[model samples]
Target: MPGAGTSINALPKISLHDHLDGGLRPQTIIELAEPIGFALPTTDAAALGTWFADQADSGSLVEYLKTFDVTTGVMQTREGLVRVAREFVEDLAADGVIYGEIRWAPEQHLTRGLTLDQTVEAVQEGLEAGIALVAQAGSRIRVGQLITAMRHADRGLEIAELAVRHRGNGVVGFDIAGAELGFPAHNHRDAFDFLAKAFMPVTVHAGEADGLESIRGALFDGRALRLGHGVRLAEDIEIGREDEENTYVTLGPVAQWVRDREIALELSPSSNLQTGAIAAWGDDLLDHPFDLLYQLGFRVTVNTDNRLMSNTSLTKELALLSDAFGYDEDDLEVFQLNAVQASFLPLDEREDLADAIVAGFATV
Candidate 1:
């Protein structure tokens, strides 16, 4: 039904795994950097955009990590945070994202003397502003923040507290990101325990740069309600060809539990290829295990991990998936429903979101 262009633009979307700093507009980066005396690889918007996407395309996690240094470098003050956050939501709203969860680590934004509380408040203000701007245009959209802690950093507890402190104030959930290989979710046990006691929802970045053991830590230790970039969970699956028209899949205990429990996997098509998470399968989107996981009944929700770095939007992501996997409106709707079910929003809110998505898709 979504035939591309305005059709896809009209379909409502729910983004569960998007990074805040990673979605900054290039012009915003240059404008914000000028006041802070921060220099970038390029000042021209087109060239700068290419630079971010190229760095991410290096297929090296270390190189990808370097790209963020420029983004985080600019988001150190109240003004920069608010401006970036405002534009981020506005862009998502314009792209037909009815509901979104923007994730970023406040600890990383403390370089230029902003208290964690101030940074959160500033971002909240920006999100609210963006919401108002959309409303003024006769369009309705909502966004919630997922307060993230860098796995390699030592500020998990503090960030978790920050998320809880702003629970009903635009903040939706908590997450642990960055350096997923060596720094297991167990490293943030104290923070996870604190969030568990506080009864907050969490999502952990696992199965992206690591395997099943990392996913186990995300579940048992971090208590992640959703698995961030859990593409590698496919490693636990064994496939064998049956007759001419059939095939069979056998899931290991962990993968079986995940599928049985309906754990949502935030599968970012472009970003996964860029970061080499799906290298075992292949490098192209066509080679991704997304279709396999979908056919296996896994809770597979699509996302643009980093909008700027990937130079993508939810519409483009869906179009690319459709092109790569020959999917239709039904498949896209499944992704939206999975994301809605996996969102940290309350029961009534999530139901409302799902209903809206269904109705919006009906138009196409």
Candidate 2:
């Protein structure tokens, strides 16, 4: 077992909620934008990185999402998409991710005249190339695309079909992200119905910017197998009595269903704080309901929702949690196992991932 000062970065990890557009290297963004004549807040990569993190820390999901404009602006072409996707994989591998599902909306990249299929193909090519590069470097990594749809847009059905079209190629799952308050998952019922008929695994962004009602819709209307930043489900938990000996709580219908059903909560510690997802609890990482949910047997997994925007990696997020909740190596291992079990891969593949994680942690 790992003792004090153990290196969390060396542990094998699985990333289920990372965003492609939101994980770009600042330097790469500068280079890509220059060629496209896209204006940025600054050309200096360090300052640009700081800008993203600072802008996203506004404690409002709507304000936090505006920073995506700069990222998606530079990703309107095939080359841009390929390069960004390639670097995203490399970064994840370096951060000790053995497997990851990179999610992005293809409809947002059509401004440069590329079709949605072409954009998906381009990203797949980049992901494959990144995997090959990692192998050449004597490291191992695997990835899949979680094709996403913008909740506020009318292309949910089209995006769902696009995801299904590429299901066997490189895509693994489907998600709906973007503003969650005004545009609930029920707005995309047609798309969810189609995906359900097609038997595609779905994860929806709910319970972050919105509350229990939105999460309820995501579960029943979208048939979501997992929740993206479903931190707000804690709203359903009522603290009854607390003392030095023990604390009692009650789970409402939504919370009980999610916990009993073992729906994975893709909790992003830093991003949740930045977007005020955990504001109801407190202002710091210690205030997060992750420990409560985990202690209650909820299938909670850690993630870096947007590495660049949050200025974090899976390793950093784990470290923060460890510090906040006094988590040891065993706790970290459980989190990884939860992520492996919740991954969108096939049963055999998820078993392989779980084995790999177990072996890796055994070494430490």
Candidate 3:
């Protein structure tokens, strides 16, 4: 245990699962909306921030997702997208995120006149600007874009082409998000097939809004290297209590494959509780299967699925998990290490990040 004394913000961390549309600064939203004359729930920045949190805590995934309409509304133009992306990276740097991957669907931003390629270029510009600003402030941070396609939509193959086309730019991976219940990963088989041929890294939103079958599809059909909020993978794990302090867990074939292959599970604590992703386990943080999965040797990584919706940061999520499951500094270090290994960056870059984490923890 080290410098995580009530505040882990200073520790070097890697964020593998952050959403661009879900992590906007409240103040920025107000400024961007005024030019477009968009109607918001509130004009005051502080109240608007609280509004997002309160509205998202509705305990239903469908209700919680309704808050994104306001966010995506203002992000139609090049200016709006650029500003949001720039601020997103700056905020991550401030929060001590050494590396982050921001995932967002470009199809949603075509409501205006801009093309999908233009939207991607605009976001990349903002990310580069944000990186320069952070460097000027004497801190270093790197970020990548995970181009996403809504699973409910029929543009899977098109979006997959877009992602591969821009791979040389800022886009690092491809993902199929949106409603995961009825729209399974197999629905986007063409996209996954394209990504596989291109040798692109893929992370799918599975086991969050669905069950083991969804995760299975993500691995087999989607060829996902990671699972977004795969908290529901625990459904395949059966835990039994023996004596007072003795317990046992049995993993089904699906769970066993995920564990044996060391596929990363991006687990967001507060968001999971807010969206009822962990309802079957329990409604409280203590009832989450994150600890169980970690104990069973799963490559678990902590994340903030939606900072604005959950009103939380990476440090806050880790602290909350520590309080709930008694995780200490060493445990936190292991989580960071896992993220470094699972990153989409090159092997050398990942090794450097791991070294930085180890060095930072040493000082702590």
Candidate 4:
């Protein structure tokens, strides 16, 4: 058994749902915003960080998403994208993330006249630079871009092509994000179909602001290999009765399929509570269905969806889960293994990551 004295921050982890734009350092935002004459609510880095957290804790998904305007506003230039992407990797490494997939929409970064390809190349350059810096410092970390398309926009097919175009580069997967309620995954069917034909892996933002129907559309229409913030899938589970020896519940078809197929749920506990994704259950972290889903054998993986917005790191999120559910080192290892298995990497690469994780955990 793993020792209880181990530090959660020291555990090697994998991040599947972290956002490139959402992980910016407040100081980086300040510097990036200056040359462009983009005015901010506050110029001080610490104050700006607090501003993001305050603005994002709106308890409404739409409102919470508004905080991204400030971030994407600064990322419209190649310099901005590179710097942000570099810092994103460095921060993940500092948090002990062995592997991370950074997701961001190329469509959103085109407002400053940079073409989609240029933006991807720029970000890739930054990611490589960050990786080199980590190696120079005698530490190691790996990252990939999950090229994303805005669900509310009509550029899905274009973005999907762009992702496939850069697959040999740093891009690893495709995703659709933004406004999940009205904009179902099927809205991007052409793009999804293109990706499916190209054999590109996908993960969709479903069961966050939406429900089972949205999750079903993601699985059917988007062909998502994983679900982003799929916490709402818990709604499909109905508890009948509980005794000292057992607690029995029934699973709806959607939940049953997800569980049986082991489709990974990228559960960001802090982000879920801030966006009210788990409001139907309760307002607190303890109220989150993460424990419920994990106990029921769902392939649940921990993530820090937006580290800046949630004012959290992967370590902090895992610590919060431990505090809420009494999970020890062994349980935390399960989440890391789950994330590694669900990652977009090839089977051999996934096995390599799993081995690294297991070796790291064994020491602790």
Best by lDDT: 2
TM-score against native, each model: 0.98, 0.98, 0.98, 0.98
Runs in model 3 lying further than 4 Å from the true structure? 1-6, 243-245
Every candidate's CA RMSD: 1.3, 1.2, 1.3, 1.3
lDDT of 4 by residue, 1-364 (tens): 2356787778899999999989999999999999999999999999999999999999999999999999999999999999999889999999999999999998889898999999999999999999999899888999999999999999999999999999999899999999999999889999999999999999999999999999999999998889999999999999975877876899999999999999999999999999999999999999999999999999999999999999999999999998888888889999999999999999999999999999999986
Candidate 3 structure quality by residue, lDDT tens digits, 221-325: 999999999999999998899999998888999999999999999999999999999999789999999999999899999999999999999988988998888
Lowest-sum lDDT 10-residue window in model 1: 1-10
Write one digit per residue (lDDT tens) for candidate 1, span 1-364.
Answer: 3455447777899998889989999999999999889999999999999999988997766677779999999999998999899998899998899999999999999888889999999999999998999899999998999999999989899899999999979898999999899999999999999999999999999999889999999999999889999999999999989998998889999899889999899999999999999989998999899999999999999999999999999999999998888888888999999999999999999999999989988876
Off by over 4 Å in 1: 1-6, 242-246
How many angstroms is residue 190 displaced in model 3 relative to the true structure, after the best TM-score fit?
A: 0.4
lDDT of 2 by residue, 183-262 (tens): 99999999999999999999999999999999999999999999999999999999875778887899999999999999
lDDT of 2 at 155: 95
With a 3 Å backbone cut-off (N, CA, C), the pairs that clash in candidate 4 are none
**52 Cα displacement, candidate 3 (Å):** 0.5
Error of 2 at 86 (Å): 0.6
